[model samples]
Target: MTSSTHPFEQEEVMAYLDGELSANRAANVAAHLRECAECAALAEQMRDVSVRLSDWSVEPAPANLTKNLEAARAEHVVAKVRKPRGFTGRLGGKFPFLRNRWVWAAASVAALLILVLRIGLPTARQESRQSEGLQLAYTEQSRSADTPESKAVGTASDNFKVRPAPPALPASRGSSPKFSSSSADGQSNPEPTAPMIARTASVSLTVKEFAPLEASVKAIAQRHNGYIASLTSNSPQDAARTLSATLRIPSAQLESAISELKQLGRVEQESQTGEEVTKEFTDRAARMKNARATEERLLDVLRNHTGQVKDILATEQEIARVRGDIEQMEADQRSLQTRVDFATVELSVQEEYKASLQGAPTATATRLHNAAVEGYRSAIESLIGLGVWALQALPTILLWAIALFAPGRWIWKRVRRTSVSQS
Candidate 1:
């Protein structure tokens, strides 16, 4: 048996020593080792090292150590008897390092509450602002409508306005302006109450007939003077296309379109929302109008002022600046107009097909192979997870378990032994 032929690797030999190799594999290794002198000698050396390492010992504990241990045992017994159950555990947590289970539990609850507040507060604020805006809209609508009820409401508003109006406020406030969407108050009186914001509706579903549905959706979009901004369908599990598209439909037609889309498939999930951009639209329109006015005045100065070449150049520059402003405002106006004309519908489409009940889940051998592979992977993963946790937590777990459970177990054993002796 030469090292060149029958010799095994260190890893293989170690695995065999650990009893990890299967019977057939281990038998092959053993047969090979019988013919391999170097490997047999190496195995013998490993055994010697193991035995030599096992020969070390520790000194015997002193008699005083025993006495001290007895005293410690007595204290532990007293603690077990008098330990204040849940309250003690809870109170212990207050001492920073000293606090144990109850403290951590309370802290966890407190942290959870803080997290909820952190997450939920902004949402609550948003809801509150929405509600307040709605209320404000209703108020402004009544003011603009100028009904008898409005007159009564106006009286209350008049009293409110009597609080020595700031110079920034317009003398005669017509209706609440949408620009007042800011956190600031008394900035501007809003234009006649904005058109009520329409509700937003969206749906995500899988449809086997998605290709056909896409055509229908496209047709609907065009009929309503809307356009599809995006559409995509790319998936293997689907024989029919998967469509995720943002369709721009008139706000008025949004609900109707969504209903039609739902008719095409079983809706996996659907949502409806309302956002009042009326205020934003109104405010932007007002600002753009003011900017245009300023721009026009600059242009007028540019045309009429035929002064020095420098002044003419400066005037032209001013006109160009004003024109730029007008262009920007025009863009803003167009965008707002588009929003009023076109509401966005975000749709997610999937194709679901009914299959033969008896013929479902074919390919048994492949499935079994996959199952075996997954099982092995899962076992390895579980073993690694256990090893990691044990390595990380064993000391702490052992210490606490010994500190807490050991005393009780010792007392129980002592009592049982005494009773047996008495018997």
Candidate 2:
């Protein structure tokens, strides 16, 4: 009848002592404790501990605490009796007119209008002004006559003629070239420049042979007075050979060049593109002309004017800036001219693939020997691959083992201790 001989666990006895069990279970435990001397002694020890704990008491609250508690209870009751105020109600308390829905709606509308006026209107106006200015500038430049030097170099209207240059013009400060049509004699009407276009083409072809086709492509480029910009060719034993190249041809000869290139093989895909850069070219030319004019005027000032050291230095600096601008614009103009003169042709040639079926049959013995050799080689390769993989994974495996073992060991110890204690 002792606790050590009873069927119930110590936890059940403790729960009964704490009155946590149902009445029937508590009664059963009480009967068992009366019969079991060990359980009765354990219950007496727990009761003693509880009695000792009860002796420790907190001090009584002050008189002010009682007044505050009563005040808080009264305020809580008042809060429950009154209607709760939401966000709009609190906002209306701060601004009485906001209580009106019509007033709130009107204020929202005013804020939206102010936002549109402050942000949207200015942005629209700025874009409109910029567009207008660009249009006007383009129109003026297009109507202006090309400089004699530009004409010799080949105007955008012309097919980029690389002719010999004429004699240079005298740098006269007294006479400056004008952007608009205005002469000492009269304002003559200006001729419009032609539209400029940069042309490009791409052609994909399937050829019977790569070597002959490649040679023909090079010959065709040479015949057209064009050159190959780049060439890439690859040939694999198990796959079809391929050749890709970029060719630069004269814009005037672009059509004829593409036609000739298509003759090397059957054309699978072909595309031609042309981009108009008339406005851009005109803008650059106009800027260059203006810079040159500025440089001429500065040079005249340096030649004719007498000034102090600072003034001369400042004048020289301005001249240097104008000269730099002129050079940069000239380079841009040349690049644009080159693009307009030379058209790009991207060409790809693929060899038509054919599978071969001509091979001598091997003897059965030889075939068996080859198979065995191949199997052995594969097995060896597999083992080597496994070894390499293990080498690569060893560090990660070790790291994970170290990380898991410490926590695993701690948990195992804790479980073992719990098991021993329960036993």
Candidate 3:
């Protein structure tokens, strides 16, 4: 490797001539070739030899060379099949097509594809079926909601009636359907259609009696089978007391509750609002139905799967996600139903202001009495606190006094001696 002595070995020179050396090493060999005539001659001979080898060509292969080799291989395979010694050979002899690796790979791929289609098709079919059902349900609900007069007035309880079982459809992938058309009485039933509404009311009242107002509000809520969600009462000096509360009452009893609350005081302000939620509720129900169907299909896939671990795990993960969505949709549906069932009320009550001369004198007398009592108590507490402080600090004071007495006495003597000397 050192350029001082023999920088280039014969093999290095050959490698340089063959263009196999790294860039820097090839450059060094090229530079050395320029300086040393012997290595330069060797490199030139190598290049000439490479050129001659490149020009040299073997005679063309026989046109049937590949055919001859394949024929030989086929004969060897035929001999092995005849002997039929090992298990593979016996199988090959019995089944002549089992010898190709490409055939095995193809069969494996075909089986895998079949399994994937089996699992996938059911899910796709379920989704399509569920979507069709959802669309049908939505269309029916919309038609029903648009023509209110044609549909008879029904109560909220009627709206929650169990839907009639749908007609039986052929199950896919050999799995049984979760729903059926037969009722307990073995008769086809019809679907029930009802409107959903969420109601809210706000009322403000001015009351004469402030003390009994809060209790009356609670009693009214209890009587109506409702609860107060929130309540705030403010009573300031020389100001009327005001009470505000948010109440949740059943929609059936909302009117009664509000009427009773009005009776408790004079109604100053009252407003009621209702929102139609038939479409929203219907949409949520449709989506929830589809999710449940998808979940069922996924479960079927998981049960019948005979694939890799990753595939099984992926299927399980998808099932879990679908289940979570289904549960969330169910929760939302319940929440919407509750909103339709319950009515919210906002109530505000203000106590009537009554000017009175009677409280002034009485209040003044009570304040005077309280002030005298507090003054006496304060004097007694101050005396007791002084006594406690003396008890706590008396020992420490005495110790300091004792320690300073000798120093004080010596200073006094020195002062007296100095005064005598000055005199």
lDDT of 1 at 256: 61
Q: Model 3, 399: alpha-carbon shift in Å?
A: 51
Instruction: Report the C-alpha lDDT of model 3 over 1-423, residue by residue, as the tens digit.
Output: 334566878899999887899999999989988998888888788888888989989899997998998998798856664554754354445445666668779957975785456444543443454565421122222334346532333233222212223213211111112111112232211112445567789999999989998899898887766678899999977778899999876665677788999999899999987777777866765566556656765677568646568766766888788788977876675576566556789999999987554453557888999999999999999999999999999999999999999999999999999999999
Point out the worst 10-residue segment of candidate 1 by lDDT.
Answer: 153-162
Q: Number of clashes in model 3?
A: 0
Whole-model Cα lDDT of every candidate shown, in order: 0.59, 0.66, 0.67
- Error at 407, model 2, angstroms: 11
Evaluated at residue 97, the lDDT of candidate 3 is 61
lDDT of 2 by residue, 1-423 (tens): 434679667778889988899999898989988888888888898889999999999899799998998898797655443423753343344445556669869857975774445333433433443454321122233333464523332233233322221113211111111122212332111112345666678999999877787789888777666678899999987789999999977655677788999988999999987777667866775566556656665677578766667767877888888788877766675576667656789999999998777577988999999999999999999999999999999999999999999999999999999999999
User: How are the candidates ranked when ordered by lDDT, highest leading?
Assistant: 3, 2, 1
* lDDT tens readout by residue for model 1, 1-423: 343565557667667766889998888778866877777777777778788988887788789998998898897755454545552233233223333457669756975785456444543443454566332222333335355433441122221111122323322133232222322342222232334343445788877665587787787666555578898877554344577888876554565667777777888999866555556666665665455555555566556545567656755676677677767755665566455445678888877755433546758999999999999999999999999999999999899988989788989999999999999
TM-score for each candidate, following the candidate numbering:
0.38, 0.45, 0.43
Scored by lDDT, model 3 comes in at 0.67
Which is superior by TM-score, 2 or 3? 2
Off by over 4 Å in 1: 1-193, 196-200, 208-211, 237-241, 353-423
Which residue pairs clash within candidate 2?
Answer: none
Report the Cα lDDT for candidate 1: 0.59
